[model samples]
Target: MNKSNIYQCADCHTGSGTPQALQAPKVRTHLPSVTNYSCTDCHSKVVVNAGPTAANVTAHYAIRPTVPTSNYCDYCHGPNATSPFPARNKTIPQFAHDDPGWDGNATCRTCHTNSSVSADPLANDTSSFHELTTEYGDAFNGSVKADCVVCHVQKSPQFVAAPNPPHDISGMAAPDCYGCHGVNVPGTEAQKLHNPTPTTTGGCIACHSNNATRYYVNKSLFALHANVNTTDGMNNVTDADCKTCHHGAADGTMGMKLGAANSSNTYFCQDCHTSAGTGPTHPSDPNLIKDGLSHGKTDCRWCHLAGDSQPRPLSSQLRYHPNGPRGTAAGKNCLSCHVSANLPDPPFHAPGESHVSDLNACQECHSNADNHAVTPLTQNTPPLVSGLSVSTQITSGTPSQVQFTVSDPMLQIAAAQYQVTNSSGIVFDWTNMTGTFNSNSVTINANIDTSGLVGNYTVNVKGMKSAPRTDPSKPYYPLNGQWSSISNAQLNVIQPTGYDNGTVYGTLGTDIAGATVSTNTGVSTIANSSGFYSLSLTNGTYQLTASKDPEYYPNSSVFVTVTAFTTITQNIILTPKPTGNISGTVTSK
Candidate 1:
C-alpha cells in the first residue's frame, strides 16, 4: 500500500491506510505574479471553501440585556463554550429571549438600562402590564382621581432607597396611614415617631387589619371630638357625627343633634308688668286719679310699638298727661285718660310741675268709664195753640148752640185769651163766658141766633196772651200781646121757604107715549087720562121739560112765563132724531 493513500479523521485526525490519503505539507513552486486572476482558477479541485474564521466575533455580537431570556441562548453561543455555535436559522423560546442584557448578575447600569427586569407584573410590557392602562384608567373614571401621594410618602426628602427600600414588598412603607391611625413604636423609641400611641396599629396593618385601628378611630373620633365644649357634651354636633352613636340620626330621629325645641320661650311685657294677678307693685298718686290723667299704662302700644326688637327712646320711657288743656300746664294730668286700676303712681315724683289735687274727676265730663256723659230727662208733648174750635148744628128754626173746645197741650192756656170774628168783620162779644181751663183741654158753650142766614159764614177764632201793661196805670184790654189766628169753621144755612104743588102729570107726543112723571116734593100727584101735564103753581115763571123712554120722541117747553095765577099749558115735544146709517162693502183687486 502507498503511503500517500493513508486516511486521517478531520477532527482528531487519527490516520489509517486507504486509497484516499492525507498528503504532507507540500512546497509550492514560485509562479510569475499575474494581475486580475480569479480565485476559482486554482480552487477548482476544492469544491467547498468555508468562509474565513471570525476574530472576537462573540464580543462583537453579544446579546443585549434588554432582550428577555436571551441569556439562555448566550450560554451556548458564548465564546467560552467548547463548541460555540450560531443560531443561524433556529427559533428562540418566548421567555428565553427576554431581558437580554441581564448577565444573571446585579449591577447599577444593568438595572438602569431600558432592559431592566421588574418583579412587578404590572411593569412588564409584553406580559399585559396594567400599571399604566388599567389602574390609571379606573382612577380617571372614578369620582376622586387617585393621587400617588395619597398612598405613598406624605412628605418629600423621603429616602426612597435607604432604610425603606424603593420597592417595598412589605407594603408598610406608605406614610399616609399615620393620619388616622397613630404611629406605633416600641415604648423606648416612641419619641422617634409621631403620635406614638398603642391605640393604632402601625404600617399597613393599621389599614388592612381585620379590625383596623384606622377604621375604628375614623368611625368614632368625629363625634367624640365635637362633644368637647357643648352644653350637654353630646348635644350639638353634625348629623354625620351623631350618626356614629345613633345610627338613624341622619334620617331624622330623637338622636338628631342640634335640633330645635318644640316650643319657644316668648312673652309680652304687659303680661308681667301690668296690674294683673301678681303684678308689679307701684306707689299711689292721688293727682293721677283726680285729674283723669293718662297714666303710664294708658298707651301700651306707645312703649311696645310695632315690629320685632323695636327700640324705645330713653325720653319716651316717662308717661305723658293729656288732661289739662292739651299743651297747657294745668291740663296735663296722667289720670285723666288712664284709669287708676291700670296705672299707679311712680315711686317718687319726677322733678317737674306735677299734677294738682283740684283737677276735676273723670265724672265731670265722662260721667263713667262705660257711658261718659250726663243724660237729661225729657218728655215729648204736642205744640200748644191759644186758639179755640167751635162746632154748631142748627135744625130749621130755633137758635143753635155751639160747643167750643180749646187745647194747650203744653199748659199755655192760663196765659191765653180768645176772640171770634165773622165774615162781616164783627167780633162775637163774650157776653156770658163759663169755661174751665185744664192742663190739656178746655170747653165752653155759646148760644148763637142763626135765623135768616142763607149762606155760609166763617168764624175766625184767634188767641192772644194777656200781656203785662207797658204802663200799669192804663186800662188793660184782654187781647194785648202777640195774637195767633187759631182756626175758623164755616156755618151753612139753607132756605126753607119754597113749596111744591099737589099734582104732577105726564105729556105725550107723536112718538113719545107711555112716559111717566112724578113730583119730588111731599105732595099728592097723579097722571091724568089725556097724558097732558097739568099742575097748579104760584105766580112765578117755570121751566117744563120732557123725555121719552126707549122708542119715542122727547118734548120740552120753550118757557112758561106767568104773571098772575092763570092756567098756563106749557107743552114739551118728545122728538126722536134720525141716526145716519153707513154701509159699504170692501172688494179685493
Candidate 2:
C-alpha cells in the first residue's frame, strides 16, 4: 500500500528512508479500498461493537469517519455525538440496539476516550433508554429488593401476597406462597395421612381432631366431651359452653320441657351454688328433703361432691343434713348428733368461777337465762348517802339536832345498822336499832354545834345489814332494788343587823344652758361646760328643771334616783337650733 494511502494505522510508524525501493509501490487502480478488518481494527479504539457476531456484521456495526470528510470526526463528535460513537450508544448503552457498538453491552471508554463525557450517561438525556445501576444500588440489596416482583416477570417470587385465602388441598404451587398462608392453610397431604375422616370443618379442627379424648370432636359435636372427670380436663369450659351449642335449648328440645324448668334453672348452676339460700329445702335437691330447726335445710353443696356442669352434690342418702345437724336444744354441742348413743360429759367451769348470794334470786343477777350468769359479791347493795339536806327549820343558837335516815325505804332496822360521820370524817355516832320500818324517816335529837362552825359542811350517812344481809326483813329496804332518798336542806345561818353606805355619781347634759340645782331627798346640780355636770346624793329620788338662757330657750327636764354607793352613768342629747328661714329668687331676660 502507498505510504500516504495508509491514512490511519493501528499504531504510529516512522521509517528513516525508503530502503532501495524494496518493491514497486503496489498501487491499485481503485483508490485504496477500505477493508472491513482494517476499518474495524482502527476504529475499535474509538468505537467498539458489543456481541460481535456474524449476523450483526454490517447491521449493528458502528463507524467513526475521518477528520476532514463529510463524515468527519466533528460530524460524529457534535454536541449530539461528541464521543464519535452512535448517539444512542453514547447515551444509554444498557438497552440493546441494532448498531454494533450502540448495543447494550457498550462500556464507558468506548465513547469517552479523549472526550469530555458525563460522569453518568443518563445524567442529561432524561429521555434515554438507559438504567443507571447506581440509582438503584441500595434498593437492589436492601429492603425493597424484593419489590422487583411488582414489575419483572423473572422476579415474581420475591414478595408475599396480602389477605391470605383458604388453602387448596392439592398444595401450594410456590413455596414462597407459604409466607402468608402458612398460619392458615392446611398442608396438602396432612389431612389424608393424619385425619382421614374429614370430620372437622376448618383449619382449627385439622390438627385438634386427633386428640378427641382432649378436645371436642368437632364444632358440631358440642356434647361429645361435655362430661369431664376432673376440672383440669375442661380447663377453658364455662357457662358459655352450654350457650355455644344450646342456642335453642331454651326454646325446647325432644323429651325436654323448657318453660317449666326456666324458673328453677334459668341461670347457670354455679350462680346459685356459690350463693347462700333460706329455703325450707335445698334448691338442688330433687326429693325436697328438709332438716334442721322447723325442718329447714342447709345448702346441698355443704356436704356433697361438686361437678363442673352442675353445682349440686353427688350423695343423697343420709338421715340428717350435714349442716346444722342438731336443734336449738343442743346449742353448740357437736356431739349431740355425732355421738348420740352416749353423750360426752358436760364442760366444767375453772377455779375462778363467779359467785352469787342467796339473798337475791338467780334472775336478779342472771339477767338472761339462755346463758350462764355470774354475780358479783356486792349485788343489790344500796349506795351510801355521801351528804344530807332538809327543808325543816330550828331556832337560831338552839343547837338543832336530828337523826340520820337510810335511803332504802323498805329496809328494816331490825336487820340493819347505821353509822354517821361528820364533815371532818370522824365517827360521831353509830347504832344497832331494831324496829319494823314503815318509811325511811328517822328522827332522834342529835346535837350539832353551831358556835364556831359557820360555813357550809357535809354529813355522810352509811347503812348496812347486820348479818351479811341475805334479804330485806322489813319494807325500808327492797330486794333487787337500789336506794333512794331526799337530800338534806341547805341551812343559811344569818345574823340580825346590816350596815350599807350609799352614794351616786353620774354625767349630765341639757337641751339649753344652765339647769337649776336642788337638794331634797337626793343631791342635784346644774349643767356645766360642754353641757356636763357632777352630783353627790344620799339614797333617795329628786327632780331638776332647766333655767332658760338668752342664747337658747329651756329644752327639757329629767328625774334621778340613788340607791347604793354606785356610779350611775347616762348620756343626754340636746336639740337647740335656729327655727326661722328665708326665701329669694333671681330675675332673667
Candidate 3:
C-alpha cells in the first residue's frame, strides 16, 4: 500500500544498455512470495512525471507470475495484533470462511480500517458466494459455491450471491471435478472422459495408455478396459479427454469441426484403431453410412449400445440394427434414432421420392434433419391442392412476401420452397419460404425483389420435409415427390392488364345455363341460356372443353391459347350420336 516502498524495475534498470549477467533484483526474483498482486511486482507511480520512466512503465511493465497468490493479500492485510483484533500469522490476520464479516463487504470494514484490508482476494473472496435475499441475482439466491462448501460449513449469516462460473455447470459436485468425467455425464461428450476410479484400477487408462514408455505393453492391462463404461456423472463425454490420450488428430486439427470441406475428419477414425484394427470401427472408410453423405449430424451413440451394461459392439460385424423400414419390422436394421419398436420413420415415401437413395443411410435425411419428401399423391387433381393461388406487390422497393395457401389435411405442415423465372428468362432460386405452418392450412411467407423484373414471373411451391439440406443451395433430399399440385402462379410485373379467357358459345343448344364449361387449369364455369360462355385463365395455352348433358354425347376437347388477362372468342361444336349400334364378336387364337 506504500507507493514509495513499492519495487520499481527502473531503480536498477536505467534507460541505458542491458545490465550484466546478474540483475539487481536477483534477491527479490528468488523471493518465495513475489506475485502480480504483491508490492514488489507493481512499480512506484512516483516516477510518473519522468518521461523515460513513464515510457518504460507503459511499454515494459510486466509481471512474470501475474496470478495472485495466497501471500499477496498479506501486504496490505498484515496482522495488527497490537490493536483490538487478535491476528494469528506474523504477516497477516488468519483468514477463515467462518468469520462474522466473511460474507458481507460492509461488515468486514467495521473491523479493518484499511480500504483494502478487508478485501481478501484468495478463496475468501465473497463475490462467488450468493446470499439468501429477495432479489438474489440470477434467481440463484441461497446458493453457495461448491468450492466454499468443499472446505467450510455455512456461516451464522446467510447471503445470496451467484455461484462462480467455475462451479456453475450442472451435474458437477464442484468445478474441481472437471479432472474426471465431464458433461451429459449421463450422456455427453465428456461423459466418456469423466471416468475416475478411486482404486488404483483406473478405467480409461485401463484400455488407453499415455505413458506408453512405462513398460506394461502387456495385453492384460488394456484388454480389461475394452468394455468397461465409466461415466462422466453427466451423460456427456469430453472429446478433449479422449484426444488427450488417444492420438485422434494426426492431422493436428483440434475440434471435431464437421462439414463437407473438412473431409480429413472422415479419416480420423483410422488414426487410432487403424484399418487393420478390428470391429465396429469408426463408421467411415467404406463407412456404415454410404454415399458421399455425412453421419456427423447425428449422435453416434443414439444407435450404439446404450443401457443395461451393454458393451459397444467391438466390431462392425456385430452391428446393432433393431428395426425394419417404414414403421414396420422390415429389419434392414438402420440402427436409427427412432424408438426400437418403430423404425425407418413413418408414412414412408415411395421409392422414387428421393434422388439420394444411392446415399442410403439414415443420417442422410434424419440427422439434425428438416425438410422431407411429402407423401406423394397418385394424381395432381383433388387433395393435391385446391385454389393454388397467390397475391403479391412491391412494398418499399422490395417485393413483399408473396402470400399463398394450400389445404393441409394431415396438419403436419412444415415449410415451403419455391423458384421463379424473371422477365429476362433468367431462372433463379427463390428464398426458402419458411415460417409458420398453420394446422390444416400451409401458408408460404417469402420475400423477392421485382424491380428489375419485366415480363411475367412463374412461381412454384413445394412442401418442406424433415430431411436436412445436404447441399443447402439446392434443396433437401427426397424432393422427388410431395404436394398434390405443382403450386404455380403467373403474375405480370409491368405488362398491361388483359383478360385471359375464351367463349364456349356453340353449346348443344339445350338449356345452356346449366352446361358446365371448364379450362385446363381446373377452372370451371357455367354457360348462359343463350349458349354464351367464356373461360377465365392465365397467360398460357390450355385445353378447353364443355361438359356433356345426360342425354347427349360428350363434346370433343379442344386446345386453345390465351395470354395475359384477355378474353378470346372460341367456338365448340357438339354432335349427337345415333341410338345404339349392333355388334358381332369375332374370336382368333
Candidate 4:
C-alpha cells in the first residue's frame, strides 16, 4: 500500500520558540494483540516538516479524512481477508430488536444476504460501524454487533418506542435513572438562567422548570433534603416525598410537621428560620400579602414570566428574567422595576452595587403604583462565611466537630450547613446537629458523623440568616447564603483496627497446625499448635485464605465483614489434596 507522507515533530518544533524534545518522533504504542508491525505497516508516518510545500499533508497533526475510500478494519475482518484471519461469521438480523419503530418480524437475510452493497453488512460494514469498540476502543467481548443497550436500555423500548427509557420521568426516584437523565441538568450558573416552568414534557426542563415532584431528585439536594442513609436517623425519602412537607391541613400546621426547628403554628419557611433565630427576618402581617409578602401581586405570573412571556406557576423569577441583576439585559430586582432612575431598561446591578446603598431604604421609598406595594419590603442578602476549621484527623464511625464563623449584614445568623465531600465528589451533608450562636460573629460548631466513611475529604461551610415572621399563616421566605460561602478545609478519616480470630481445619475436620491464614488485603497470620489464628486488620470486608502447603488446597473464598475495635470469628476449612494417583497409566507405558 502506497501511503501519504506526514510531517515529523522536528519539522515544526526545531524552529525558534519550540522545545528541543518536541523535535523527535514519539514511540508509538501498537496494539499488544498484534506483533511484528512497524510504522507505515497499518498507517503512515512523519516524513517532511509541516508546511504548504509538504505533499499530501494538511496540518501539523494527523487528522483522519472525513471520507475514506477504504475500511482499515476490513483488512482484518473482511470476508476474504487472511492476515489476522476473518472474524467469526455470526448471523445478525438486518434491524435489531430494540431499534426504534421495529415491529419484531424482519428476517436477517433482508439486508445481510442482499446483493445491494448498501443493504449488505458484509459489503459495507466499516471500522467505525460499532461505537463502543470503534470510537472508544472497547473490546467487542464476543458481541456479534454493537449493543445499543450499552447506552440506553434495549429491553424497555416500550417506554418510548426508542432504545432508551421514556423521556417522561415524573414518577422516577433519586439515583435511579438520575445517573444519566437527572444529572444532565445544566450545571453552570449562566446555563441556569431559564425561567422555571412546570411541564409534562420531561428531560431537564421537567425539573429545572420547577416541577415540584421532579425538583428534589436533583443530585445536589441529596445531602440537604433527600434521605441518603439510615445511619443519619432520617426516613427513607422517595420521589413522592413532597407530601412529607406540603400535605398539612393548613399552612401554619404544615410548618410544625417537619419536627426540627421550633416553628409550630408558623409558616413552613420558619421551620429552619425561626423568628427567634438569627435567620433573615420574616414580615409580620398575613393580611399584608400585597405589599409585604407577595410584593402586592396576587397573580404569581407577573414576576415569574420571562422571555417566553408565559406565566409558569412555581417557576423561578430570577432564572427566567431575561435580564437579571448580573448584567444580562434588564434587571429583575425591586429597584430595577420601582426606582425612577432605572426607568424602562433598568440597568443591571452587581452584588453589593453602590447604586442601592441600603435595602431597607429602597423598600420604604418605592411607590405604590402599577401593583407595587405601598409598605416596606425586605430582601435577603446571604451571610458571610469565614474561618472554617474542621478536625483534621478522625476515625470512621466516630463524631467530630466542624467549626466556622458567620456574619450577616441585614439579620443575625440563623442556620448553618456543613458539607463533607470525599475525593470522589460524594457530598455528605451533616444534618441534625446542635448549633451554638454568639453575638458578634455567629460561630457554628456541628457534630459531624463519620460513619462508614474513611478517606480524605473537603469540608465546606455556609450560614443562613434569621427568619422574622409578620404572620404565622403566610408563606415564609428562606434566603440562603450558600453561594457566597467558599471557605473549605481538608479532613482525613482513618479506619480503626479490628481483630480477627478463627481456626483453620482440613477437610477431615482435623486441626491444620501452622496453617497460613491470609486476608485479601495482604494481612496474614499463622495458626498455632491448635490451629487457631488471630489477625489484626482494619475495619473492612476481607476474603480469607487458609492453606497448609502440600497437605491441603487453599481456601480463599471465605468472606467476613469486620468492624472497628471488634473481634469477629471466621473459620476457614481447607480442602485436602486429591488422593490416589493413576497407577494404570504407568503399566500401559
Q: How well is each residue in 1-589 modelled by candidate 4, as lDDT tens digits?
A: 1134544432432234235355443322232123343323333333344667555533333432232333333333333333332233211111222222233322222122222122334333332332222221332233432222332333231212123343323333333343333233444311111111111125322443343542323334333233322343554434233323233312223321112112232223323223343322333454322323334322232343221222222233333212221212233454444332211121211112123444465644445323334443344455588877788589887877788787755444445676788868756864433454323247778777888778888887766544333333432222322234457888888887888898888778888899999888898888999999998888689888888889788887899888769999988888898778665544553
Runs in model 4 deviating more than 4 A are 1-382, 423-426, 429-440, 466-476, 480-483, 500-520, 524-535, 539-563, 567-589
Model 3: how far residue 317 lies from native, Å: 28
Q: lDDT (CA) for every model shown?
A: 0.31, 0.30, 0.37, 0.45
lDDT of 1 by residue, 1-589 (tens): 3324432222111222233444522211111122122222222222333347533222123222232332332232232233223322122211111121233232211111222333322232322211122222222233433222321233222111111113212233324333423433333211212132222334322332333322222222223334422443453443333233333322333211111111122122232234451312211442222222232223233332211112221122231111111111222332432222111122211111112223354344434322112221112232234334444444334454555555433222222333444566655553434444322344555555666554555654443222222233431222222233445576655443333221223333342334443332222223344545545543455554444465444444444544433454544444555557899999999
Q: How many residue pairs clash in each candidate?
A: 36, 14, 53, 18
The lowest-lDDT stretch of 10 consecutive residues in candidate 3 is 320-329
Residue-level error in angstroms, candidate 3, position 289: 18
Top-scoring candidate (TM-score) = 3
Which tens-of-lDDT digit does each residue in 1-589 have in candidate 3? 3336554544443234245423543322212242223333333322235654344443234433222233323333345432322222233233322222334332222112112223444333422211212222212234532232232223112322222222123233433333322211343222222132211134333322333322112223223122222343332233333333333332334221211112232222222233443323333334332223233222222223122112432221222212111112123233322212111122221122222223244444445331121122222222234454545533223463566665433223334667777566646674466655423355656666665565567877666432333243432223432344467777555532224333344344444445566766788777666656666555577776676576445564777777654666776665554568789999999
lDDT of 2 at 25: 32
lDDT (10s digit) by residue, model 2, range 1-589: 4434433332221122234443423322111142223434334544444644433223124343333322222233233434443422122212111122233222222121211222324323322111222223212333444221221122233222211222222222333222222223354322112112111233333433443323223333333223221243553333333332232332333111211122242332223323333222133443222232110012232222111113222122211112112212224221221122110111210011112223234346434222112222333545344334432243234463445555333222222233434456644344443433322333322455444333444433343321113443422112212333323434333221111212121223333335444444444566654445455554455554343344444433545565534555443443344567678887897
TM-score of each: 0.21, 0.15, 0.27, 0.26
**In model 1, how many backbone clashes occur?**
36
Largest lDDT belongs to which candidate? Answer: 4
